[model samples]
Target: MEFSLILKKINNTLSAEKELIFNDWYSQSETHRQYFKGVLEQFENNRITVDNKKGWERIDQEIRKKNSTKSYWKYAVAAAIVIAVFSLPFTFKNTPSDLPPTTTLEQQATIEIGSDKATLTLEDGSSVVLQKGEHYEAGHIKSNGEQLLYDSTKTTPNVDIAYNILTIPRGGQFFISLSDGTNVWLNSDSKLRYPVAFAENQTRMVELVYGEAYFEVSPSTKHNGSHFTVTTLNQEIDVIGTEFNIKAYKEDPIISTTLVEGKVVVKSSQTFKKLIPGQQSKLDSKTNSIEISKVDVSNEVSWKNGFFSFKNKQLEEIILVLSRWYDVDFKVQNTEAVKIPFNGVFNKKQEIENILKIIENTNEVKFEIKGKTILVE
Candidate 1:
């Protein structure tokens, strides 16, 4: 069998399958190990542009020509396959809202919810301690797994509730369940505001003051009639019941709403667009235009799932996201560095230094962290 075919199988395998394939291939011969090393070196050196198939093809052909062996064809084909798999990060549609939007009930949104550390504030205008290793809960409110849950059924009757704001700093994360049974997962450096409970006959609503969040709204009582709406940055997502993710970070240029299930209408006070499952609606800050497109919802919501999945993301964009999560300041030495795109998925639990090391292995760039500052060279 050709090395390309072997690698194709390896790339597509899950953890256990990968382990099996690696063990089988590695035991085949010493030459197989050497070939694996060569491929690893190419990836580490950033010789492969994840989005540039042509550039990779050229490089692979050159490597084959220099080797001048009948086995060279396998290398070229394998390199192309590997490059395509890795380049998944950078592939993007021309428009943000190219994907179709959902029209069913069940609206969902994913939001970034924390910062460098998690803390809580009390109603007494005093800061309360939310130390790690401790869990807190009350009627309609519970927190576990670094997330806060809100169940509206437990609130006191016929009284306006005082809303408390929860802010998650960079490097910190949290989740929340609302009184109306809405669930939100907040990424680093985010915030959400909600009442202790909804008053009688009050509309179910929560404000995303900052950062990003993913929401899974409970079905409305009328199911066929009533609508649930979330407001942020001059935009409103109205739905009856849907699953979707919304990213409205203050620093980002556009507010992105990705629908995963049900139907949603993303409306700016002035304009509106409806989105279907597997499609996204984008609110552009500069032009103020609403763009729509089909997208892989999983990739957009990966952060909430404990992973940082980058698909054809520019080096600068990656750094920006990292800066927010790691709570570090970065200074890019060269402007052109912003144009360099790469693809990879990293677990958020990993140390910042480990990720930097992985990028440094790309050989095209190096980084040095001084105190709180990250200097990219």
Candidate 2:
């Protein structure tokens, strides 16, 4: 682990690959863990913490504060002292409105962080619950609780395509390596349907079923020029050796397909839009139309990188993501607060209360945790 990783994690700019390296270092020693915590304190203390309620205004304040350069300098000096001492590295969806606005519910609750978990439904409709430390296998498909993998080389010819569905529950996530070498990172409250193996000399296909996923597709050139495609409720993505993210949660009114690298063509009933890196195509569920726009790809797919990025995200959006991962519900008593925006990057492993505290610190929004339900005032 390098010193720069500490900076990246604190800044919420750490990538998925670097995160693994940081984690390995973090688990090695208690000294490393203490150093990590110290670094976090320095960084968080110096930076002007910001969140949704105030939207981009808070972001502007943070930017202006950074431009002053004094806080960052202090943080850097503190971290440098840590390096001189010890080394360390660091790393929603909708909601329902089922609460009565007149009632105020506040109770202490312990919301644990989610881990790798999912329900796999085989072609025969038999379901298997996958959780951390558990193992399951069928034919060439194997899952080690953390990830599911399929061995394409062991596939049999002339057999009908056996379909399997993987459903991710709230407060959980899972990874899968498909038969074609395509890698998929599934977020909380998502589901995907795919074949056990693809037929030779044909297109490989899968469906989002619902929720969010980041796909790293195996190029067609590697498979005799066979194509790969992903179908969601709103649009279909034609891929040619690319990495992309799709957000199509059941409660979300808009379906977003963000291309991180390479190429992808998003098709809808109206027309098809080809997207390049740093571009996102949003399909409105009500209109059945696709709109293309430039976006910060890093922020767009930050969740896959083990960070919940709230740049330009509204309170409603942030809450949806938080609710899904924390397995809790948030009731916004101040309805208009739902549109409030926040700007910050948080580690998913951080406690739900820490985040609630941050938002509450703004004084613009107040959150009362009542068991699994939070009353947002």
Q: Candidate 2 residues 124-219, lDDT tens each?
A: 999999999999987789999999999967443545778899999999999999998999999999999998888787788999999999998999
lDDT of 2 at 115: 91
Model 1: ten consecutive residues of lowest lDDT: 99-108
Query: Judged by TM-score, which candidate is best?
Result: 2
lDDT of 1: 0.64
lDDT of 1 by residue, 1-377 (tens): 33334335435643675667676877774334544553454345444443344544465567656764323433433343343334333353224243222122221122222243456554555554443567776554556536666665655455657777778877677777776777777777777776667655555667777788888887677333446778887788887787788888888889899987788888885689989888999898666689899876656776765557666677898888888787777898967756767666565655666566555533456676666677787
Q: Which segments of model 1 are wrong by more than 4 Å?
A: 1-117, 122-124, 138-140, 155-159, 222-226
In angstroms, give how far residue 251 of model 1 lies from its true place: 1.6
In candidate 2, the residue pairs with backbone N, CA or C atoms under 3 Å apart (3 or more residues apart, or in different chains) clash, namely 51-342, 52-341, 52-342, 92-320, 92-321, 93-320, 93-321
Question: Cα lDDT for residue 264, model 1?
Answer: 88
- What lDDT score goes with residue 307 in model 1? 57
Error of 1 at 25 (Å): 31
